[model samples]
Structures are given as structure tokens and as C-alpha cells.
Target: MTENATGGEVTFADMRLRPELLDVLSALGYEEPTPIQKEAIPPLTEGRDLLGQAATGTGKTAAFALPVLERLTPQGDGAGPVALVLVPTRELAIQVSEAFHRYGRILGARVLPMYGGAPFGRQLQAIKRGVDVVVATPGRALDHIGRGTLDLEGLRTVVLDEADEMLDMGFADDIEAILAATPATRQTVLFSATLPPRIDGIARRHLSDPVRIEMGHTAGEGRETTPLVEQSAYLVARAHKPAALGRLLDIEAPTAAIIFCRTRDEVDQLTETMNGRGHRAEALHGGMEQEQRDRVMSRLRAGTADLLIATDVAARGLDIEQLTHVVNYNVPSAPESYVHRIGRVGRAGREGVALTLVEPREHRMLKAIERVTRQRIPVERLPTVADLQARRMELTRAALEECLLQDDLESFHAVVESLTDEFDLMEVALAAVKLAHESSGATPDEEEIPEVAPRAVDKRRGPRESAHDGERYQRGPGGGMTRLFFSVGRSAGIRPQDLVGAIAGESSLSGRDIGAIEIADRFSLVEVPQAAADEVIAALRQATIKGRRPTVRRERDTRGRRPR
Candidate 1:
């Protein structure tokens, strides 16, 4: 580290990063190292174990990724990846893998992200072909190791990104098993948002003499709110979300935006619906092939598409320079995921907006997110019809001004003169504007987007409603879901996937739409859209589960709430 001419604050150029990485950094417009990067990079490059405490968007990925890439072996045939980064989710695995690929691109680094739901054959092929670094979720990495398809004998570094989250997702055993497989001398690194006991236990077990680095707002400073984005949410019922989102977009008029949905089904449906509403929208999800994902990204980057409707997993690690807005179609299940979603916007010191569409039922999740982030997410009313029309007129006025300033009007003056001879000049101008407004594809019907009535929060427990609170679990969001009780449970060797597959095979509903599955020794509760509840119940009765018919009934009935 070198001293700044004025003080001792060193820049990234002063750090001992490889020249190629520096070049990439410069090309990417990274002027200085973030605090975590400043402290963690040096030790990491020196081949030391690192335990870093940093939140998402604090540049933790690069803290570990770049050092691992720098330690890669010179290009040559190798048994397997030299570096392994275990992440909590498929989205993160893909994101970290891409980061390593980008930083190491100049050095011809080969990186692969291993995760579930993706085709096993494709992952296997990539593993067999050889790679320099493997960024994976613990479960998939272990699966490959068990099949003897992934070789870790050549490993030199092992890093755990979001260590706490990995533990939260119940991958502690998988992480331990994977760690045990790696060489004893391998350098280990662990990064987490908070160092809970479990994370500390893992660090003690694996990370030897690790350098620790923590990054975030200082304690006692106290947060007014997360200061990056102008965060707001709308209480729009599920049925009116599409219309509400359209109206919100009209008000926002963002250069580019990402509309986050919970599932591929929603992403596909929303993308299709948004396009129908005259927006240039695209769909991205794990269900699509890599080629399709690349195509969608190409369009987004080329400015042909302005809106990306994607699931959290598919949109992970995506950095769009023109991204001016991030919309949550539904409140995220976890607050950390919410942080990651909005982190995509309000970056690089630019003012950006984040809007979430919350149903009355999900008001609790909104509160939960606010509590976790130590800030209040201001809830806003849905835009009225008059508001939408005013915004449309404002946009029309701006467009006309731009045209007048830049476009040559000499060709149209004669036409204007002839029209002036027949009509008033103001009337001619109004006619031209009317034609422009009509041709601009703005919503013709300025109907108000319906708003969801605000759900009153219970003073003691917040906005969450439980079983006694109207059996709300039976009444899922959109008021179209029912929880069905099943007689067969663990004693009968029933699994969640088994219940999922059985219902999906017997009915029109896919497993993705299934929610809130609970399995017990003698019974199980499965939630499906109310419209399909009877159909699912009927189909399950006729179709044998585990080769036998199991009693299935709607939990809507009190007796059905108990095991048959």
C-alpha cells in the first residue's frame, strides 16, 4: 500500500492487483477501491483466508473473486477448477461466476456456475470440458462430486459467499461435506452480512487465521432510511397489478427498468402483458435456454427493450447502465433479497426510484422488510386517472419541444401556411398535437388503477394474519388459493416434491404455482389456487400417490384441517 500524496489513503492502482485486472477496472470506470475491497484484496491476493462482513452491493464479490482469479494457474490442461466459490442460491452462483469471467476475461479465464434446475447434462459437459474456476451452490457441487464428474483435487482456494444465507437455507451439512473434500492446505474465505453463531462456527472449522473485514454504516449513526433509492410501495390488489404497474410506469417514464416477479410463470405472463400494453418488455428466467437468455440481454443492452420482467434468480448480477427503476411485482420473501433487487438501481451516485406493488395481505412483508433494513418504506396511493393524463400531456409537450428545437420545419411551413389560410393557427397546432399524441401510443383510456384498501396492522404482532385471523393461509394472495390436507405424510415416505409432482401430474396447475407446503408425521398441507383445489383433490383421489390412493380434501372445511 502506498500513501496518497496528501495522506495515506491508497487507490486501487496502488494496491498489488495484477495489471490485467487493473486494466479491466480502469475500463469499467472503477476509480477507487471500496472499503471492503481495500481491506480484503491485499490479504486475499497474499493467499490468506478471509472472513469478511459486508452487505450486498458493498463490492464483496470482487473482494474474493479477483484474488481467486489472480491465483489461477497459467493456461494449461488441469484436472479441475483451481478455485471454488460456494454461494447460497442459483442466482448468486450465476452472478459470481459471471463476475469472475468478466475480471479474468483478459487472462482467458474459464468459469462455470453450477446450480439446480438447470439441465444436468449441460453442467456435466461444462465440468468435463475443464474450467479454471467453479462458482457453485453447495448442493449442486456436492452432487457433481458424488457422481465423480467434478474434480477438486487441483483446488487451491475455497470461498463461501453469503455464508449466513447458505446456513439459513439449510446447506450447513452440504458446506461441511464440500469443505472436507477440498485439500487441507487450500485457502478458505467466508463472507457474510452478519456473523451469527453458525457462521462463526463454520469460520472456526474452516477458515484458518482469516483476516476479518466488516463494512456498513457505523453503529449509533442510526438510519433514517436506506439512502440509496427513493423507495416507495403501492397497495394494489393482485387483479389490478398490471394496470397499476402501467400507470406507475407512465408516471416514472424511466429510461430502463426491471420489473421483478416471483416465478417464471409470472415473468412470462407479465412480459407478455406489458408488451401488449405497448412497452418493449422481455422475459428472463431459469426455464429459458442460455442462448435465449443471451438474446434477451442483448436486446436489453442494445436499447431495443426497455423493460425486463424477470425472476430474482434470472436477474441476479445484471448491471444495466441505463437502469433507472426497479419494481417489485410482489414483496420479496426475505428482506436481503429485497436489498439485492433494489441495489441494481440507484447506483454510481445516480438518483433512481424503486417501487413495489404490495397486496393487502403482503403489507406484513413490507413492514418486515422495513424493520430489517432499519428504515420505513413510504407507502403511496395508486395514481389517479387525472395524474396519468397530466403525465402523458407533459411527455407530449417535451417531445414537441424537442422536435421544434432539432427538426427542420421548412418542409412543413407551406403546409402550415395553407392550413393557416383555411383555419386558425392555434387550431392547426392543436390538430398536429392531437395526431402526435394519438400516434405516440399513450394509453387512450385514462381509467384509474384500482387500489387495495390498506390493511390495518395489529399493534402487537404487526400486519401478519394467522389461522385464527380468518384462516388466511387457506385464502392465499389474489384470494384464489386453498390449502389441502393430505392423510399420508413422512410415515408413508411422502416428500414435498412427491406432493408437488402428484398434484401437478393430476391437474392443470403446475408445481410452480403451489405454495406453503407443510409436511408432518401423519398429515400434510398443500396450498394451490382455489379454482384448482377441487380438481386437484379429485385428481389425487383417482391417481395413486406412492402407489396408493391417499385421502385428500380441502382444508377450507374445519374437519379437513385435521388429518383424515
Candidate 2:
């Protein structure tokens, strides 16, 4: 169903939202409703069951969330959980819960997120106090139900988000059980990227005659061409990829992009490597907590993060309008996955670019992708010094053009006038332009990004230790000193680099500030500058490394003997 034109003005004013919510959104600068929100909000507000098919990053969360907020009653005397949202992953559960909290804060609406990995006592406590909304993953929600800690008897609305992913992850039975427990008369909404048969069965079984809204496709038209996507690929040795990718990014300089990798470990390593090369990069994978993922996405959306290295599963359903590029760090196993990866860009009639880094052996897979998509992905060569220079010049010219278009140049005229009197007008103009361009790294003669060996195929925890050896070494604490720990020597998977990275990324401490890290299976010790110990512990408390929270704190002395 299309959005009714009548509600346009009201729909646009998320500011008219409850005062607290308006403050949050306004502070966050969310000024407009995405297309999904425009179409889904009205019907949902009317209490109609809905089946919405939309891509990731289309603001689907706000689409369903706004209506949920509008319909929810305050928690003052409710026995509920008035609204229940079931997501596939713990990360999504937290994200949706946070959204509900943000939107309903002014209304005094209470929302709780329940998921695995977190201690159950916190969830139980929150439930006992009463919640207007519960955002949960299927497995943990079902656990709560079986334990009698969660009651859905008062639930008014039930939402199944990313239903297909849940099904894919083997949670279909759990989903069915959860839906069965909810009241039969409740308003049911299911949102998925695709309507596979499994999803169709779920809809038929649960939803009363629903209004279906499928965005991105016209009634009679065939699949629309991704005219905005400028598809290209490069052949490089596996060892040369990092350097090649860095160079490509340097030349293209996408406003935002997600570099898709095959594994979580790869995501972390690539993110660190990219950051070292001076790109504002972040990593997203299942290994991170919901809060961390949210922060990473926030950074990406806010332009604080220019490159996001992530696994496909972690990046699923991510829609970032500012994303102008999609890079395949490794060839995807299937062509459909490739399509989904690149589709993240070239959306909503905006131009986008997709680049795939293909190893020699993956040429056949590339050909297979071409066969399935019915489009030829042109092979491109690595950028040479000349090409890099030309690209920088183009960027400089673009910046100058933009500056000329703006109205804030009156104060700068004096500087230009004084310089013009002292030198030839053309030379002065060029010099001033050169200074501005150089400040932005738009200099044609800027040093080339170093060519590291292509990333080696190692099953180890870090990059290759030697220039020629494929054996990767974990990153050590940067400073010569090491922090002593009392907890290590037994159970934790704590490693030297793990301690260093966790401290450096999560805390205010720089890589140079961290000294040395020593890890044992049960407990581990790290070395950081004494001055930054408190900050390091505080940061570690919030960081999730290797799927578990690090118990980082100052080491208490057990014996009189201390190592010098």
C-alpha cells in the first residue's frame, strides 16, 4: 500500500513526537522520514497487520517503531509487555530496544531488551518492574517464556523483524512457538528482505488478512536496472590486497562504504590495518556487543568513520544513505549474496560504485557472478602514480568549485587581495588553492600509500609476523612496559594483542600508550602506562572481546616478591 498524501505534514514532524523523543531525534539531526517510514507508518498506526518487504538501511526500524510508540500506553498499571518485537540477533534486539526507549522516553514508556550473553538477572529485574515493550531474540525470549518470567497475555502488537534471517539461522520453530504464545487477536507485523516460502507460511499461520507493502518493485515492471551502480573489479594477489584496497580507497575516496569480509577475525584485522593507514575505520561483526555495534554504525553515519570492515552477517539489512561505495574484500560464495552486498549502494536513484578484489583463482567465481546478474563486471587495473595524481587534481578542483558556490568568502577576500598585490594574480591564486588543497591531502604529489605484501592466508590470530613468512603475529602493546595482572594464567583466552587492542580501541589510551600484554587461558595481565590504568579498565568494562567481556582491573599483589 502506498502512503496517503494527506498525512505528509504530520508524518514529517517527528519533532511533534513526545517531547523527550523529539529532543533525542533533533539532537541526532534526523530531519526526514525515509521512504519506508512514509509508507508503513499510517497503516501500522491504524492497527492493521502488515507485511513489509524492504532492503536494509531503508529506515524500517523507524517505520515500524514510530507507529508502535504512538499506539503504546504508558506502563503505569499494565501487566504487559504491550508490544513485542522479535529480532534474530542480540545486537538487533538491543538496537530496537534502544530505538523504542529513545522514541517513548517523553511518554514515560518503559522498554527492555532481553538477549543471550548478558546476565539473566538484569532482564528479570527489568521485567519485574514492568515494561511497555520487550525487544528480544527468539532463543532468549523463548527461554523467558518457559521460565514464566515473560508473559505475553497482555501483548497488543507483535513484530517479526528480519524474519528471513531468523528462519535462515534455524530459529523458525522458536519463532512459531513465540508467536503461538502471543494472543491470537494481536496486530501482527512481519518485515523481511525476502518473502521465502517459510516466511509465507508464518504469515498465513499468524497474521489476519494483512496489507502487504513491498518497496523497490513496481506492479508490472521487471527488476529495475541498478543504473547508479558503477561496477568494477581488480585482480590482485591475496597478499597484495590490503595495499591495493588502501590505494583504491585513496583514489576513489568514498564518502562512506562497507568493505565485506568473510570472517569476524578478518573484519577486526582489516579495520586495524586500515586505521593504521590513516582511514577512519571501524569493525562490525557478531563478536561485538549491541552497544559497540550501535556506536560503530553511529560513527559511520556521522562521517566519523569512513570505512566499515564487516562480515556479511553483521552488515545485514544495514542501510546507510551516505554510502557511495561497496567493496568486496573477498569474493562472496554466491552471486545472490554479491547482489545483496552491492545493492547496499546505488539506491534511491543516487549514483554508487562497487569494487571487488578478486584473486586469480576466483576468476571463475567472478564469471559465475556475471552469468547470474546478466551484467559484465569490468576488470580495472591498479591506479598508477599518474592516475593517483589526476584523481587528486579532480578532487581539488571539485573542492574549489564547491567553495566558489558558497556565500562565506568575504573575510577571505582580504587575504587574497593582499597576496595578489605581492605576487602575480594567477600565482597567488594557485598558491592559495594549493595550500587549501594540500591541507585536505588533495596534493597530487602526496606520498603513495605503502605497498604491504598482499594479506597472507593464515589461520593464525594476526597478520604475518615476518615480511615473507605467512605466520601472523598478534599486535603487542605499543610501549615497552607491560601491565601486571593477578587474574591471568588459567582460563581466559586473553592474549597479548587482545589486551592491547581492547585498551587502545575502547579507551582513550593510544597504541603508543599501551606497553605489553601477557595472556593465559584462565586470566591475563596487560601493561599500560600507569597514568591510563583507570581509563583502560573503564573502557574494557564496555568492550566485548572475543564474544566475552574482559575482566580488566589493576592487579592486586598476592606475594611480597614483585618482578623488577
Candidate 3:
């Protein structure tokens, strides 16, 4: 292993990777190993179980991927797959699979990324032909296992990437089942951004004699670590978030930005709204096909698209070099999630901005995140119409300056000279500037977003608590919650996670926003925010639950009348 005399910097060459992998790393311009990578590769290459805690953009992918490639067996050994990597989302599965392919190019590694929403026949054929590595989502991995298409007896290594995210997506049971199918002697490695108690329980149960490593934002920086991200929030009412976001984007004028939303519907809605406002915006969510997603990403990377409005799951594992801003459309459900979202930007020593739109009710949630992250996120006033006009004038002035310096204006000098003869020189210049400003597609925002103050609450009461009490009558953070009835329940093998995932996947309500759920023998009742009740009902009516469309409706009283 090669290291500098100071013993602080270690090159990828020092990691003892094979010649092929080293050459690929060099070609990719990777000089040294990240903190997580440096500490993990050694133990992992030695076949020891590992539990690593590092946030996004910390190079954890290379840490696990390089080791997996280093230990790959030769092809045509009749071994289905020597390595199995389970991720939370299909995007991450594809990303990790591509990394393995890139690093293992010289080894002729047969790597496959298996996930839902792709052609099943192709994945099945790939497995039948034989693969050295399989990177897959937990649910799809379980599907193949049940179909007898994926055999784990020959597996030598099992990696759970983004382990906490999988659990949050209701894949814990599926992960446990897949792990149970793998060989007990196989090397197990789990990586998560946070070490919650549930994560610890999984580590205790799955990893044996593991090497534990924990490093977050301050990894290798010690107490002097400083975040490069400028975090701020805007206190706008729920109804004005779209306008506020549009105004903020106009003033900020970022090179590129990723706006995170909670659900697929929200992503689509915001994408359309932003596009109408003259921004080249794109939507990415679970509903999009693989091909469509590839097109969106290509457009963004090629500089044709400026805004990527995406759901949390679909946007996982994406790192864009030119990203300058990260906007939270709503307060994140969890504080750890806030950390992960902001981590996407402010990387590689580049300054980045993190902006958020906070509704009155979500102020408390935002405060909780601040307390957890130990960072103060000052709420800023939304930009007014006057601010927008000034920003547009500035942009027009800069554009005109660039044109005068670079463009061939000699051709238009004759027209200007002729006009100057009939008009004052200053008047002609003002006319020219006005035409330039108008042609630049600068539309002034008229209405001002109403500002809302945070609700003052008694010290004893919670922010979300309503006047009513009892588990049966609980409300969401916003207001009262309404219970909806589904025809299928325990008999159809329905679980809470299944319902949570279904609602969260289809509607604007997140899993955290959902209230108590009761599953009976033949029916189920789930509580959603009262304001979102109709939307949830409409979405569920259109979606299938457990492969069957269940009759959905607002629960009624014993008299068969709707509850008031």
C-alpha cells in the first residue's frame, strides 16, 4: 500500500487492486481513496463482514464495489452469481451495477442489474446464461428467488447497499428473506448513512465479527469540518409554494438544480408547473420507464435541462457534477433524510445552495431537522415582484455586455447610425435596451406570496395535536385525518408496509404522514390527512393493491352512512 510521507493521503494504487481495476481508476481520474473507501477496502478484501456508516457522496459505492470485483471468480464456472448486492431502488441498482462493469472491464465481469419495471425475460435470460455479480432491489431479488430463477448457493459475497433506505421503503422483510437464502458462509457487508436502532439490530443479526466504521459529513475533517452548503428556507403558505419556488429560482438562477418531492404525483405536478414558467424542467419518479429516465438524465448532463424534479427513491445514487442547488419542496419526513438530500451538492469543494419551501404547519418539522443536524436554517422572506424585475434587468445587462464584446455588431451599425440621425443617441440606446430585455423572455411576477408565522403552541402540547384525542381520532401534522376502507386485508396477505408503500407511491402523503392502520380478516382501514383524503381515495381507486383492485371508500358508520 502506497501512502504519502505524512500518512494522510492514500492513492488507489496503494489499495492493492488488480492491474485492470487500477488502470480503470486511473482512466477515470481517481487519484486517492475516500475516507470510507480507504478504511473499508482492506477489511472487505480480506473477506471480513463490514458495517459501514457514511452519508451519500462519500464514495461508499467504490468501497464495496472494488472489493466485490477483486474477489470475482472466473466465468463459466457454472456458478450462478458469486456476488449479490441488494439496493433500495432500481436507480441505485443500475448505478452500482454499472460501477462493477466499469471497474471489472478487464476481468470480463458478467454483471447484471435486476429490478422491477424492466423486462423480466431479459433479466431471466441473463441469470440463465450466468452472471458473476447481481445488483438488485430487495423485492425483485425475492421475486427471482421465489421463481427459482435466482440461486444463491454459489454466492460468495452479499452486500446490502443503502440498507436503511431499503428498510424505510418497506423492504426489510424481503431483505431478510433474501439473506436467508444466501449461503451462511458468505461474506456479509451492510452500509447505511445512519445507525438507527433498527439498523443496529440488523447488524447484530446478520453481520458476524464485523469491522464497524462510522463517518458522516465530518469524516477526515475532525472538529474543524465546515459545510459548503448555504441552507435556507422560505415560509410560504401551502398554496403559494409553487409561486415561491418559481420566484426563488428566478432570483437564484442556478446553473442546474434538483428539486426533491415526496411522491410521484408531486414530481409530475411540479415538473409541469416549472416547465410552464419557462424553465426546462424534467420529472423523474418510479412511474417513469428505464428508457425515459435515461433520456431525462442525458438531457440534464448535456445541459439541455436545468431542473430535475424527482422523488426521493427514483433520484437515489445520482451524482451530477454541475448541480448547484438542491431544493426541498417540502420538509423531509426524517432529519437523516435532510442530511442525505443536502449531501448531493456542495461536493468537491464547490459552494452549493440548499433551499426549501416551508408551509405554516411544517415549520415544526423543519425545526426538528435543524435541532438534529445542529445547524440553524434561517427562514428567508420570499422575493417580491420588484426583486424579480431587478434580477431580470441585471441578466439583460450582462447578456448585452457579452454580446457587445463577442458578437459581430458591425453589420447592425448602419441601422443604428441611421436611427441615431432621426433620434437622440440616448433614446436609441434606451430603445435597444428595452427591446433586448423584452426579447429575453423576462416575465414579471405580479402577486406576492403571503407569509405565514409559525403557530405558537403551549409547551405541553405537540405541534400536530388537535383538539380531539384517542388513537381512533388522531390527525396528521396539518390537521385532522380521515380513515379510508379497503376491501382486502389479512386474508390477502396485506401488511402495514405494503399499505404505506402503496399510498406513498401513489399519493402526495408520505409514509411518515400516515396515521394508524388496522388490518382485519377481510378489510383494512388506513388514516390519511383530511385535506388529502379525496386525492388518496382517487389514487387508491386507480391503483391495485396486492395484485387486485380493492373497493375503496370513506369508511361509514354502522348505519351505512358516511361519518360526519
Candidate of highest TM-score: 3
Q: Residue 521 CA error for candidate 1 (Å)? A: 1.5
lDDT of 1 by residue, 1-564 (tens): 335567866777777778898888766545456667788888999999989877554567888888887777676249598899887656567678888887899988989888655567998888778888988876667778877988988898998887765654446667889999999999999988668888889999898898987655344322323476899999987789999998898789889999988656678789999998889999997678999999999999899999999877688789999999999998864566677788888777777789999876466557656656787899998889888878888889999999999979899899999999999999999999998887777666767666555433332111222323122222124455667888877677665655655664345554345666666677777888877777777656644455456888976454444422
Report the C-alpha lDDT of model 2 over 1-564, residue by residue, as the tens digit. Answer: 323356443434532445555555554435445556767777888899999876544567878887788777655447668889988666567778888877778788898987655667998999988888899877667778977999899888999997765654446666788888999889999998668788899989899889898754433221343867999988776777897898899898999989998656678789899998789999998667999999999999989999999877688889998999999997765566678888889888888999998875355456656656777899887887778877777888888999889978998888888888889999988887788778776544544433222211121124312322112233333545545453533344434444444443345443334444444446666666667676666645644544455566677653464542
Question: Over the stretch 16-63, how does candidate 3's per-residue lDDT look in tens digits?
Answer: 888889878766545457667888998999999999876544568889
TM-scores of the candidates in the order shown: 0.55, 0.47, 0.57
Q: Candidate 1 vs candidate 3: which has greater TM-score?
A: 3
Where model 2 places Cα greater than 4 Å from the true spot, the runs are 1-10, 14-24, 219-249, 253-564
Instruction: Provide backbone clash counts, one per model.
Output: 1, 17, 0
Candidate 1 at 515: error in angstroms?
2.5
Best by lDDT: 3
Model 1: pairs clashing at backbone N, Cα or C within 3 Å:
480-530
